[model samples]
Target: MSRHLRLALVQASAQSFEDFAQGLRSLMKSPNAAELVIYPELHLCSLGAETMSEREYYTAYAEPLDGPRGMALAGLARELGIWLIPGTVLERGADGAVHNTAVVYNPQGELVADYRKIFTWRPYEPMCPGRRFVVFDMPGTGRVGLSICYDAWYPEVTRHLAWMGAELVVNLVQTSTSGRAQEIPLNQANAIVNQIWVASVNGAAPTAQGHSLLVDPEGGIRVAAGMEDTTLLGVIDFDRVAATRKFGTSGDSWPWDQFRADDSPLELPLYNGHIDPATWRPAISPETRNDLRPAGPVVFCRPAGENGPQ
Candidate 1:
């Protein structure tokens, strides 16, 4: 059987929670509705940083993982019988720090995975940075990794996710500045270097520049949406990810397969560490791919001396 996933990327504008929910309902009503639907970052938060203070915005929207908003989103996924990634939510962590967290719900309404934004757009973004990388399996379909808006700029984020067996990296974005021009190319580059599918869903007009796109494993733009509220629908074949890694990107480059079993670790002065050649290749394989299913909350790694989330 073909491991194909029918998905939809919703390039939506900033809107109230009620409006967004209604729009999702409308989307499911269509006969061509997708089996998996994803929205842009903070698509449900409707953040108004210009009008209110960061604390006020948090006070207004931040909630725990089991909060009402999260439950409602899960309910929608269960009702629609589709995998749902409603983008990042303002999660009020138990440690008292609010995080820009991306969440995923399976068809059964289970909150399978949630990843905090490790690279929180720096000085501008007030949310605390997440420490770990996250990826979840979609049973027989594929394993997917999660990344937020600023995470794409850091190659380490996508590299680690791909290493952890992610065939597709769903990067939820919401960029309302000139930075989006750079983000588009970064998405393709991430896909090219990692040899994984990239679905970058950005918020539409008023909230963002809205050039949401999907790039194949070979770094080809399969589909892209302009600055408008539209849906980019496509079928992702996980087999292609395996084929790309087996053969070569454009049938010429084999970045992951270049490592040898006896190669020594390469030093890195920046992180004061070294890349272990023993584990250099991606962990995914036909025998171990099914093992990528969620196994509690796993934190891939953190900087030396850095503690886990506070």
Candidate 2:
């Protein structure tokens, strides 16, 4: 197959957890077609200047790993017969802690993988990190992995997934064009180093400056949109991913380590272990990397004795 699988990246502004799920179901009926559909990070809520209590309204929409929304997504996956990568959200536990989580559902309506956000940002404290990475098989194609928005910035996360036989890496992003332009390159490079397809979908319009992009393992931009409020549809060749992984004439050929995924069985229990939410972090750095870049806006910090708005 040569770049035949269609992909859809939804970039609309986020709503509540309930509305978000409903919205996802609605997108499936969109005029565009995709074998795989990806929602942006925090696909459940929008960012506002509001305080934590107000933000809690959004997080309250959070659920456990085995909650109703999870089942609903699984049903949607089954109904559409498409692989879906939902973004991170606040998953509350019985211990009164919340976690930033990413859940994947297969066409069969089963929970293929659920990855807790390893690297979270502010307002996402007391969440936990998933100890390991997860990869699953695509019906007629190769395997794929998932990551949250912040997780995209971390090299190890991408490296881990790439090493684990992932032909495709889907990153759900909820980024703001506040102070950085690192979004595209960071996700694209991850694909290059690992030789796989990388898909990143971010929010659009009043919520963000849209820049959703799809990149091939060779660092090629399959499709991209820079306009605000724009959404994009593209195709990726799953077969090429396998061919690219092969090591030419040398026995030491393929750069990918097949052993990385030898034991990553999706049925294994989540490593939620002794790890505490208060210590969890997003898979990537939430801070914008353009603090010193003259092309972007400058970030001014409050001093020890600022009296303007303290």
* Per-candidate total of colliding backbone pairs: 0, 13
The window of 10 residues in a row where model 1 has the poorest summed lDDT is 301-310
Q: Whole-model lDDT for model 1 versus the true structure?
A: 0.85
TM-score of 2: 0.72
lDDT of 1 by residue, 137-225 (tens): 78867788899989999999999888877889999999999999999999999999999999999999977899999999999999998
| Segments of candidate 1 deviating more than 4 angstroms | 285-310
The candidate that wins on TM-score is 1
lDDT of 2 at 215: 91
lDDT of each: 0.85, 0.64
State the displacement of the C-alpha of residue 292, model 2, in Å, after optimal TM-score superposition: 44
lDDT by residue for model 2 (1-310), tens: 2335787887767766577667666667776657778777776644542445744754556677678877777887898888877666667777756667777777898887767777775464445665667666565455667777778888878876654556678887777766227878898788877777898888776676668899986778888877465557887776555445443212344443333323333332454443222221112111212231223122232221121111
